[model samples]
Structure formats: C-alpha cells, structure tokens
Target: MDTTACTILLVDDEAANLDLLELVLRPRGYGRLVRVADAREAVAAFEAAAPDLVLLDLHMPHRDGLAVLAELQARVPEGDFLPVLVLTADATPAARERALAAGAHDFVTKPFDRLEVLLRARNLLRTRLLHRAQRDARGAAELAAVQGRLLADEW
Candidate 1:
C-alpha cells in the first residue's frame, strides 16, 4: 500500500464509530483522510477534497447511506466511477442489495476486519481508476473518428 496518492472520504455520523474507522484506515496506510459527520455534506466534501475512495456508513441521521450513494451516482459522469464502501453492522440481504443498487462498489460488515477493509478499499480504487482510464481512451477514439470524418468531407 503505497498510500502516497490515496485519500478516503469517510462519512459516519457517530463520533465513536468515526474514531474507530480512523484507527483502522490510518494503520492500513491511508494517510489522507477527510471525515464528514453528516450525510448531507458528503457530496460537497467529496468534490472539495477529491478523495480517491470513500467509506460510507449506512445508517445516519438526515440522509442514510443508500441516499448518499444515490446522490454520488447521480453526480458522477458517464465515464467517471467512484469507489464507495458501505459500512454497516446490519448483515441483512435486503440492505446489501439496496447498497449495491445505489452504486456502492463494495460492502463492509462492521465489527470490522482490519485486513479485509484495506483489501476491499484498494481493489475498489483500482476499479474506479481503470474505469476512468478506459473512458478517457474511448473519448480520444471518438475525437479521432470525428476528425477523420471532417477530413473525408474536405477531400
């Protein structure tokens, strides 16, 4: 974990829970961390901080994790993918399904495992970066096709 370029935007309303997560991620080599206690501020914090990954807590006061996930999905462009890890003590199948449908890249059941958290975070970040790179390549190809079409018209 060369944590040099990684930042995690952690969204958890509970102070104690937030502290526990900080302990987990820090030792795992995630040095750049921004924590927002409210779900409402997650989007703004995400954009402002520009984190490479996010660890979202499922249960919150005003807006729940599912709601926040939906918002993030709405904001991301077609080619942009954000890695969202939903942390929940609840292990119900319905909860997992909803989180996945709302755009979370993975789920972390709480009473957290030190190793699994880091592994999932790293994997999801890789997925997001790859998706963005592929999108950039597609955009470049589209631009080249348009240029070729214009050149053909001139000829």
Candidate 2:
C-alpha cells in the first residue's frame, strides 16, 4: 500500500498542536490530512474523510478524548483497522489505561519526541494497510468460490 495516499484525521482542540502534527507529517509525504479542532466535529470529519489513521487529543472542551474514542468505536465497523493514536500531556497510568480500553491503538504523551511519533504513526499505518489488504484478499476469494459454484451448477 502507498502510505502517502492514506488520509489522516487530526483531532485536536489546539491550533498549535494541529499545526505541529501537520508539520511532522507533511514532509513525510502524507498528503491528505483533515484537521478538526472541535471534538464535536470529529465524527463528522471522520465520516467525511474516511481516514486511515487518527491522531487524537485526550483533553478537549466539549467532549473528552475517551468520549470521542467511544463515539469512534461506535461509528467504525468491527474488524476495520483504523488506528487512533492518543496524544495528550496527561501521562498518568490511569489515562493510558482508559485510552487503551477505549480503543486507542497507540498512546503518545505530549511534548512527544518527533522521531518516536513518526515511527509509531508509521507502524500503525503499516498494520492498517496490511489489514485492508488481507480483508480484500478474503473478499476476493469468497467471490471466486461463489462464482465457481455458480458455473458448476450451470454445467
């Protein structure tokens, strides 16, 4: 899969954080990025963008990150590999636990290392792409079997 073609949804209340995330990803050939400052608009943006990955902020005004994560969980179909990387300054164990339980694929605390962020995002994207490929292959195989059965019955 071409990672550069993947769409990424950036969900952060702070403009600076959004800018920073764009800065980090733009140079890496990540072309399609959708930035959403309000948590309220996240689901809408997500639905519109259909992003392969989401970089989410834990603390927001209208809705907390965990709540947003829950909403996302409900929206995204089961078995779909849409990775959500929780980015927050709250490095507490409890926060990490909550995010993970809420369906975050990876957690990164704020003031995050640039290199680490890139690596983590890359890894998650890789997994997502692989999952999509496998699902597609499975679907193709199922379709082939159905077609084969139909031809056998016709004969």
Candidate 3:
C-alpha cells in the first residue's frame, strides 16, 4: 500500500496535538488524515474511515484510549491487523506495558520526537501492508489448489 494513499486516524483530545501531528505527517506524504478530538468518536470515525493506521491518545474524556483499543480489537477480525500507536505523556514502564498488553502495536511518549513518530508510523503501515499481501497470496494459492484438484477429478 502506498503510504501517501493510506488513511490514518488521529484520536487526541487536544487540538494542538492533532494539528501538530497533521503538520508533521502531511509533509511526510500522509495525506489521508482524519482527526477526532473526542475518544467517544474514535470507534465511529474508525468504522467510517477504515484507516490503515491509528494514532490513539492514552488519556481522553468520556472514554480512555485503552477502552477505544479494546473496541477496535473486538471489531477487527482475528486474522486482520490494525496497528494502534498509543501516544501519552505517561512515560512510566507500567504505562508502556499496559498499552502493549491492551493491543497497541507501538507506544510514543509525550513530546514525541517528530522523526521517531514518522518512522514508527511508516514501519507499522509497512507491516500492515505486508500482512495483507501475505494473506492475499495464501488465499490465491488455496484457490489454485482447489481448482487443480477439480480439474484432475474431471479428467
């Protein structure tokens, strides 16, 4: 998948954070960006956009990032992958472990390094695309095998 064409959902309560993220990502060729200030809107936005990646803030009103992550995890099929990168000011080891255990593919501390964020996002997107490609290939191979068996039986 082309990074430029990939849709990314940014879920943060702070407008400034959303703006900053958009500023950093747009220049890096991430054009399809969706921003939501309320964590409550996240699941709806995600369902509507079907984004290739998600940048989720750990703390938000109404529903926390962990709750949102759980919702997303339940929504996604078992075989499908949705890379959730959790962003938070909490730099504690416990916070990081919790986020990872809650289904976050990656975590970024507050005051994130612009370069690191971009690199991580890019890497996650690449992984998602690779997984999709592998699944498609396996599906095709299975279909081919079935067709071969049917042809042999007919002969």
Candidate 4:
C-alpha cells in the first residue's frame, strides 16, 4: 500500500478547542491537521482534503456537527465507515445513538481524557488509512478491467 501520513481535520467553532486539539495532536507526530472554526465548512474541507480522520464537535454556530455528519453520509456510500470520532458534551444515550445512526464511528465526550483521546485518534487514523488503501486498490483494479475491455475491442 502506498499510503502516506494521515491527515486529520478538527472542526469546531471555538478557538480554544482548536488550540487544545493542536496542542494534544501535534506532539504525537500528527503534523497534518486541518483546523476550521466553523462547522459549516466541514464538507468543503472534507472534499478538498479527504482527511484520514475527522474530529467533529457536536455543537457549533451555523451548522452543527451532527448536521454536517448527516450531509456527509448523504454524499458518500457507507459514509460512516470513514472513522468519524465525535467530540461533544452530550452524553445522553439518545444523542449517542443519533451520532451512531448518523454514521459516527465513535464518540468522545467533552472533558474527555487527553491520553484516551489521543489513543482513539491514532486508532481511527490507522483504520481510515487502511480503508483508503483498499478503496484505491479496488478503483485501480476496476479501471484496469475497463481498459482491458477497451483494448480487446480495439483489436
């Protein structure tokens, strides 16, 4: 697999939240972090960067994380398979279910353990990278099949 270092996107409306995320993730060799202060911009960033992991905050101005997650799921198949780790203060079972239903891979409540968050982030990134490799391989195989068919027709 020709996989490179994973890229992570941290989405929240709070500057302090971004600061904390960068502080925690930077030392762990997480050098490819894309931080956005608005939840609304997540989709564009997701499309443009195709991050290996997304750390989505539950609440925000304009569009919340849940809303963004919904949009994301609609756009892609098996959308929740992308390793979405939601960060929020909502500990309610209903909220968690909503997240899970909306395609979140895991939930990390606010005031969470720093070490635990780091571990989760690393684990999710690994999963995403592997998934990406698989997807790329499948795409290449499909393209080769189509090209072979075209060449056979030409002959």
Backbone clashes for every candidate come to 0, 0, 0, 0
lDDT for each of the candidates?
Answer: 0.84, 0.92, 0.94, 0.84
lDDT of 1: 0.84
Candidate 3 wrong stretches, greater than 4 Å: none
- Local accuracy of candidate 4 as per-residue lDDT tens digits, 116-138: 88988888877877776788899
- Name the top lDDT candidate: 3
Give the C-alpha lDDT of model 3.
0.94
lDDT of 2 by residue, 64-91 (tens): 9899888888888877878999999999
Q: What is the lDDT of residue 35 in candidate 3?
A: 99
lDDT of 3 by residue, 38-135 (tens): 99999999999999999999989999999999998889987999999998998999999999998899999999999999999999999999999999
After superposition on all C-alphas, the RMSD of every candidate to the true structure, in Å, is 2.4, 1.0, 0.9, 3.1
lDDT of 4: 0.84
User: What is the C-alpha RMSD, rounded to one decimal, of candidate 2?
Assistant: 1.0
What TM-score should be assigned to candidate 1? 0.84
**Model 3 Cα displacement at 121 (Å)?**
0.0
Best by TM-score: 3
